[model samples]
Target: MQYTGASIRKTAAHFNIPSFKAVSQWERIYYEQGKDALFKEQRGRTSKMGTKRPKKPKTNIETNEDLLAQVQRLRMENEYLKKLNALIQKRERSEKSTK
Candidate 1:
């Protein structure tokens, strides 16, 4: 209420608010609508279009070994790409030196 023309930072600090942006929004709402609007629910609707579908759980068929193998394969591919990039950069440097 003391923030009629006062800075938002000072108001937030006076109230020990983590984010000054919240104070800025509250001030905007207070001016536009009223102080009662601040007491109302500020959260938006959870779902407006339709109800959300829950995620399906993986079956027991997905074993730990299969997950580990997949991770190893991805790591090998990432290492191969890094080595290939280094070789390409080396070749480019050599070409530049020759020019």
Candidate 2:
């Protein structure tokens, strides 16, 4: 009825339905997926089993040597950050003492 020159509001009113939005949605579903799509059970909330979470992709670090190299790099970064923090604290203390 909506596709045949009838307005959504008028069609909804004539059918004694609550809102024109519902009519519009039905028309959209009908056009997109056809009539069979309307008869299928609607899923309100997706169950944990129904949803498949995408897996994280594996990195190029496949060997033990690669893992060790990454750990060493992280350790070096951590040491650098610690040294920077200590320097900042020492500078602040010196400034405070001078004041």
Candidate 3:
């Protein structure tokens, strides 16, 4: 499409594509890296050096112990928060009663 000297918007409208910017991007990629670039997966953020950053694992499922430790930590946090809330409510009630 770009080789014929047509504008990005004209080409996009002719092909019924939603965005002219997307057509311009495709043209840029095609010119820089050939047709293969159009089919390649382009997920994730690129690093400062222009390479794809390594993706981190979604979950740390290396061992049962790790999962158990996370659950225990979360339980402790929940208990602490509940105790703090109870103390705040008690103080508020005492203050209201005195007033």
Candidate 4:
């Protein structure tokens, strides 16, 4: 493997890889171990045991109501933060004018 001193991102982009981390990992493995190391599969191949989680079923109306509630909460939070910021700026302006 001839590495021409190219940046990891550039090499990843050249190979059309979405994540540069994968390219860097491969590069590290290639440089540390040998080319043969890259040929081996990932460590967790044989066991393939994954955690299972149960899914909760929610009705469409309930889901929509939950989403709307979250949206309203976020909007109220945004408005409160805006007002707080305006008050802080006003206080700072008043302090500056007094000095």
| Tens-digit lDDT string for candidate 2 (23-86) | 9988899999999999988768766575677987887647998889989999999999999999
Question: Candidate 1, residues 1-99: lDDT per residue as tens digits?
Answer: 563767889889889998999999998999999988989986976666776799788666678899999999999999999999999999999999999
Candidate 3, residues 1-99: lDDT per residue as tens digits?
A: 646888889999999999999898888898899999899988778755867789897784568888899899999999999999999999999999999
Which of the two candidates, 3 or 4, achieves a greater lDDT against the reference? 3
Best of the candidates, TM-score: 2
Candidate 1: residue 54 lDDT (0-100): 90
RMSD of 2: 11.8
Residue 69 of model 3, lDDT score: 93
Which of the two candidates, 3 or 4, achieves a greater TM-score against the reference? 3
Total clashing residue pairs per candidate? 0, 0, 0, 0
List the candidate 4 regions with Cα displacement exceeding 4 Å: 43-99
List pairs with backbone clashes in candidate 2: none
TM-score of each: 0.41, 0.44, 0.41, 0.40
Candidate 2 regions exceeding 4 Å error are 2-4, 43-99
Residue 84, candidate 4: alpha-carbon lDDT: 100
Query: TM-score of predicted model 3?
Result: 0.41
Error of 3 at 82 (Å): 47
Ranking by TM-score: 2, 3, 1, 4
Candidate 2 lDDT at 19 equals 94
